[model samples]
Target: MNYLRGEFDLCTGCEACLLVCSNRAAGGYNPRLARLKVFRENENLINRPLVCTQCENPFCMHSCPVSAISRAEKTGVVLIDKEKCISCGSCIKACPDQMIRWDKTGKADKCDLCAGNPLCVQYCVPGALKLVKKREVPGK
Candidate 1:
């Protein structure tokens, strides 16, 4: 399995990743629509990128009343099936990281690793975001 990693020490808060991700995922350039988010701390001295880790035991998937969220067997990416979704907000409430959200269509949305080619990782010029294989991660 592979997942996105974020390093606050390397982040510049440029929001390039958000722009690119929003364009690809929501068909817009708005950062608010991006699947991931960047948070600032210490009077904006620290910028931390927050993305879906694609947990081994994803609460978002288990909380879905209609079973709209599922982890892909091949990629381990938690995906939301809009067709089956009822927009009950269960997954959103279950996510501790607040990764899941409601899209423009009022359906649940979250990162799917862009189908294994994340635009956020690509656009993160500061290298704060990375798509890392689970085995390659230290202390995993």
Candidate 2:
């Protein structure tokens, strides 16, 4: 499986990735609606892209009362079944990385890897975000 990796060193904090991601995820242009978040630290010298790690044991998935969230078996991507979602905010609170967000419609949002190719990776001019095969390390 290939998980997306974000590099803070190459990030310029331009927020182009956030804009595109928000539009795609929320059908709008609000950064707050985007699944991916950029955290600026060190006086904006570092831009950390906070995305869903697609964890082996995702808390968001387990926290959903209605089973709205699930992992895609084919892609290893975590996805939300919007119709099944009741907007209870449990998944939002369960996320450790704080990547899940609330869209204007009040539904929880998170990255789905854009079904395969992520727009954030495509538009990242600085090469900060990348899609790479998962490397298995001993005991990992």
Judged by whole-model lDDT over C-alpha atoms, candidate 1 comes out at: 0.88
Candidate 2 structure quality by residue, lDDT tens digits, 5-116: 8888998888888899988977778777777888989888788887776777789999999999987767778789989999999998999798788867888878888888
Among these predicted structures, which one has the highest TM-score?
1
Sliding window of 10 residues with minimal summed lDDT for model 1 = 131-140
Q: Which whole-number lDDT from 0 to 100 does residue 91 have in model 2? A: 90
TM-score of 2: 0.89
Candidate 1 C-alpha lDDT tens digits along 22-123 = 998889899989999999899999998899999877888888888898877777778999999999999999999899888989999999898888989888
Q: Estimate each model's TM-score.
A: 0.94, 0.89
